[model samples]
Target: MTRRASATISTQPSVTDAPLRYRLIHDQLKNAIALGKIAPGLVLLEGPVARVFGTSRVPVRKAFEMLHAGGLLHTFEGRGYVVASPDGSAPPPLRAPLSESALGFDEAHAPLALPSNSERIYHAMEAAVSIGITFGHFRIDESEAAEAFGVSRGTVREALSRLRDLGLVEKSAYSHWLCGPLTARAVAHDYELRVLLEPAALRASMPHLSKEKLTLALAEVERAIDEPDSIDADALERIETALHVECLSQAPNKKLLGMIGHAHMPLTVNHAFYNAFNLHPEAGTLVEHRAVLKHLLAGSTEAAVTALADHLHAGQKRTLQRLKVLAVLPEPDLPVFMHRIS
Candidate 1:
């Protein structure tokens, strides 16, 4: 008979109290391993762990790497990690069901409250609503959304409420949540705000911009442009985010940054357009992004600002064209959670 590892729960600090989210997840998993709660030879996959934690796979991936490094986990013949035996020997892989309870995550003892289900579903819903709005106004079915995401109704409500805060959705007078018919006027309004604000934010952020970050940003653009056919909506969005979001993240003013974030509805618009049409970004966009990144790399703050503003101006036109195409095209089938109101 194999000897079981002694179960020892850490008494130091709550996992949630960790500053970095990945670190928190790592610590929790490590503790679980130490306690033998994670059975030896159990296969731990990223997607399941992310869903269990109500987080994206990125953090779970990082946590898995940390565990593997610590010898608590080992790479097997297939994907994901297999728990190592207490004697550091390989055991038969166990593809058993993993749960919070099995991992010693419970309310009474460690109290490792997973992130709210709302957070887990927010991005998917955001993408749906953002893309749906371009074609026509929509009324979101809260119950259906909850069912679709396999979460509670209250969770969907919280996610929609956050969208409302971001100006992505609105509550009707009759207490219904509405998304949009994203009009050219609304698109222009968002671009106008971005044109005025983002350049200023860029200028403010210039001194704080690191060379390595700029180089990486430049590399991403180059790669996307070099491999246009392979580029997907997510990659395209990352390039846009590198310039508009990540690059401007170092600006000194919090209020200004907050306002800029709210004004970035256009980014979503572009993202929706590309995804809806199954298209890649135009060469022009890649070039414009490259120009601004180059200017920043060369330490030309003013040039970078000018290039960024110009790019936004040009992007507004391209975005308007995308809206026009959506206007002409047949309306796509709405998701179960969405119903056309107009």
Candidate 2:
């Protein structure tokens, strides 16, 4: 039995967040080499450079490739990549833009939230899959995705498998990955499962629910529902996680928690609803959330379960109604890494 913690939901993804350590390293290295700090013809060892970037050799190798491609570095005869002269003169350290923070040091922050290259690829693929499904059914070509993301076929498959585990993707008989055409029926069906599983998880977590934590979560919901113009991305994430992820963390069953983790209606629907209507979770949703939390804090498991059911039912109702409008919206522009095979 593993005690779960707050759900590690990915933030609203932009292309900027998509995994690209190599690109980031490459760009920084380009700037460094161009400014002559590395010195022309000095060897760039993979191990030392990787340690500096707080990453392994893989992304650093990728970075080297980009630098080699851009003529800032060169490969010796089966030896190593050495810095190449940008021009006849060594460049001074060019000042970074005032808008940029000088925190390239690994301890302070990373260029991305995901730590590993594979994790970054996973997020990038998830975003691509989500937008693809919203538009229509599409067969994801594994090899093509590998080529597109500049990763191996294994990495592409691994990322796809994670998405499949999330219930946002599926494999066809021919071993091809398929994603959806989001519809009224599918949305309602998903909510049906949520109504049962989520509340049970909450009930299971009752013993672990803390007064302070529940109070904080309940307060977040109140602020979002009661405050004017509280429909920003973080507010939605806070309220949604407070109910769906944080409360469910109290469940001791690892398998149950894993199953609940895959159901991302809070992230998906709430994000889409906000995009379409410029609104957060509707007022009634907050009231139901508050009621469930209030009951749980009071040790009334039965009341919490009932209120949770009503909350999910209402969410399902509203979600289905909004699907029509979302269905008509244009497909988002996605990266080459995801090849949508209709």
Candidate 3:
């Protein structure tokens, strides 16, 4: 996700106008990572990188430092920095069921209500993380983050604090916040929670769900499948949420609706998983989603649940395959548990 600049450029010449040389370098390195040209766990050297970029050590140092603060690169005692491993080992292999313990937000603390300034910073961070724009490769400087959000540095800090509590962000050795990398384990855990909650909610609402509502929901899912490339992160999110929530909303049970609503962030994380794994043409995850929607609209809750479960399991397989090709992890040991679902 490209960060949309809210502030207009000033006519006056300033450091901001000069296009921070380090930012250019940062973007280049980021593009390389995304392209898999530089695999994760590869170390980066400041002196060598600076020489390659035809710049002095200062900007290169700043760029690596920034990446380190974002959790993309990790610092060693004397080896400079290495691309951080996604799971602190190898990334999880495909077809791996998420560990049961990995599901909920870090229970270390609760999210607090945000003030206006904090809210702005939070929104900016959320937008970046959701669309894989940042991917733990850049730090938001307190003053810069404040300026970006039109708030005070203190408010930005407050927002960062909240994100930290949620495990969405972590503090670096440099006292900067490094947004954590999205992991498959985390994604699968959220999907499990959704599977548990959403079907029940939809079932409760079946008696009250109007034909028009069901039709519209199925249409949205179909549209998403038809135009996967055209869909933005936000649109993808909406379509995924509607598939679950449209029917769930008709439930007479307010408590169930509230629970589903509370799972919104987790749902977003789960959607991100699909975004990452669906990179392969063979996955056809959108088609699988459409299949689940078809079953749901046919008033076949059991079939929908079975289809949804298979869809998720297939995702695990595809993601693992991609990761192996990228050499992030070895071929997975296909588990017997997945067969039980079938």
Candidate 4:
């Protein structure tokens, strides 16, 4: 057998102590963007960037390349790169606040529209989760996403970056990305966090949850439960998230509500596990949710809390069991972190 070539090694002195030149450049430019020093849509030329950084073109070029890859910079055939904008213009105008009228259905009977970013991000997230659950953990490159979404690479990148920020996807050391193969421990831990946070949220806002909001939430849940096909796991996941979010929205604590909102990924991933294992039938879930809803409607906070806790624990147990059967998760010990609904 032919011997493998000796591994090549760099001869340069270790620059471990020195500031990473490219990272510095990256931060500086990012700050400029954030501070509006370079306005949106302004072109960033490598030669000019090098001169500004007082360095050779190599590092600046590399930095620009990195930014471009990150979707913060847009590249064209002849014009080099410019700041990427989601809409390619000034940001869209703000919409009116959500109102009772706004919550009403159209003649065609679709649910009222949510914000564009919310809708787009939600759909993209569902697709990402579905792909992850079915295919195992896999990295999605920008080009693949661009084609998949029928949008520009910049839009896809922007979405991916958002997902990354949400902890739904993580970038690998080798530049690959992974969605989920979410360990059971991680799932249990996330649910524990949710349980600790969500019930308290519902209790705090139970008085504020208006009839309109309840109606909207109930409709969403019913729609999800009534879906004809079992394989539409994405729809089921969305409906599930919507139900929990609707409950949390009743809480008047904006900060706490925001935290609950951010908990969606873990919730979605956990539910995906539930779907994979068929832990509970639709009728079973409907019965559980109905019990919780009845307690809430009756203003029985303690009863609602108990019901919600039991429901969440059931889900956690099912997920953990499935993980064990798959041989992909370790057996959890006593006093294991469980999703607490405080």
Worst 10 residues of 3 by lDDT: 333-342
lDDT of 4 by residue, 1-342 (tens): 011232221111112333555777787666555555454565566665555455667777888888777777776654557675654443323223322222121222232222333335444444444324332454556665555445576765666677765567777798765666557667677678778888888788778777675666566566546753442445556556645777767687888877766655555554544444443335555566767776777778889888887777776776565555545433221111111111
In candidate 1, list every pair of residues with a backbone clash.
none
Q: Write the per-residue lDDT of candidate 3 for residues 60-119, one digit (tens) a residue.
A: 789888877776677665466666565544332222122211111123222222235465
Error of 2 at 121 (Å): 3.5
Report the error of model 1 at residue 277, Å.
2.6
The sequence of per-residue lDDT tens digits that candidate 1 reaches over residues 1-342 is: 011233221211122332555788899889888888778999999988887877779888999999889888999899898988888776889997878876667643333455556776776677777778887889998988877777799989999998886778999998899999889999899889999999999999999988998999899899988888778778888888999998998999989999988877778767766665567779999999999999999999999999999999999999888778667766665678788888
Candidate 4 worst ten-residue window by lDDT: 333-342
The residue ranges of model 1 lying beyond 4 angstroms of the native Cα positions read 1-116
Candidate 1: deviation at residue 270, Å?
Answer: 1.5
What ranges in model 3 sit over 4 Å off?
Answer: 1-123, 130-144, 153-178, 226-229, 250-283, 316-342
Tens-place lDDT digits, model 2, residues 174-258: 8988888766677776776787798889889989988899989877777766773655645776687788888888898878888
In model 2, what is the error at residue 267, expressed in angstroms?
4.8
Error of 2 at 189 (Å): 2.2
Candidate 4: residue 163 Cα off by (Å): 2.6
lDDT of candidate 4 at residue 263, scale 0 to 100 = 58
